[model samples]
Target: MFEGVDLEVPAGGLLVAHGPAGCGRTSLLLALAGRMRLSGGAIRVGGYVLPAAGRRVRATVAVARAAPAVALEGRLRVKEVMAERRLTGAGVTERRIREAFETVGIAPRGSDLVEDLGPLQALLLATALALAERPGALVVDDVDEGLPPDAHGSVWQALDRVRNSGPGPTVLAGCVRTPPPASGLVALSLPRRSLDRLPAETAAAREDTAT
Candidate 1:
């Protein structure tokens, strides 16, 4: 549950939701992506209001979960992932896929199996998939996890490119610490709260501040 949470991300701005482990960062991301139930308040993406009854927000928003435990069919090759997404109605083209891989600095080959890549590569591939959807807003949890400190800048630079590419997508990423310089990222910190106890007024105040 998130309390006192208020934030506004400008179109195409990179917003980082920074906090410690178990802080409501992931939950907040899930809520914004319309994957979790919110007991109160509003979530708006572009001009559409989320959590409205029967309103589908997933079509315009994309989320890449922290740790990105996405199950890839081990038999599928890297190119197949892009191909399958296109076949399934995602607007990804071969060129776009190639470009996304290049943006993330990955050399995606047709013969490379998903399971053969290390964790960082897998995360980058997942990000590429999300980009292929051409969402108006992108939510990524733990943008820097599992990556060596030296590699953070390159990864953030790629994300910066994605953000600046057009009226592109608004990015909301969660992290445990301050992000690197290239993220062009601003932050909103979620407060620590006890799950067993409800502090309604306190949460409300934080939300007030966030807005």
Candidate 2:
């Protein structure tokens, strides 16, 4: 719940939504990504209006939530996920998958099962999978959750590379506190309130980024 919330996010910039637990950070991210609907106001991304009919907004925006389950079948190998994504027309190539893994500093080992990877490795793999799509925008929630503090910097570096890559993408990260340093980063604070009063300009700005 965010009331009369207004924000300005520049193109190719990183926006960190910071607040305490249950303060609607994730909700705001989901709403902006079109995974959730707001009771009032509007959301647009990269000029594509959200909650629109037959819109391919999901393809343009990649979202990784906090403690997101990898949904890896026990029988599937690490490489199989990439294969499945390609078979399903996700356009994920072996080279792209390899590059994504390398981007996160993970070595490609096709023999490894998803269940065997440690927590940090699993998180990196998930991010690689998302990056393989080369989406125009990324919405990550609680990036630091469930990880040792030392690993946070590496993850932040990876995300920064994603944000600074060619043409790049607008990134909106949700968290219970401040995010690590990154170039061109902005912070937005959300306080609990009725969602109906959210600012139209801010919603439109979000839509522009999504587009």
Q: Top lDDT: which candidate number?
A: 2
lDDT assessment of candidate 1: 0.66
TM-score of 2: 0.81
TM-score of each: 0.81, 0.81
Tell me the tens digit of each residue's lDDT in model 2 across 13-108: 888888877677777777666666666666667667666721466667776544332234546788786687666536678887787777778885
Q: Which parts of model 2 have CA positions greater than 4 angstroms off?
A: 66-76, 191-201, 204-211
Cα shift from native, residue 104, model 2 (Å): 2.4
Worst 10 residues of 2 by lDDT: 202-211
As a whole number from 0 to 100, the lDDT of residue 95 in candidate 1 is 76
lDDT of each: 0.66, 0.68
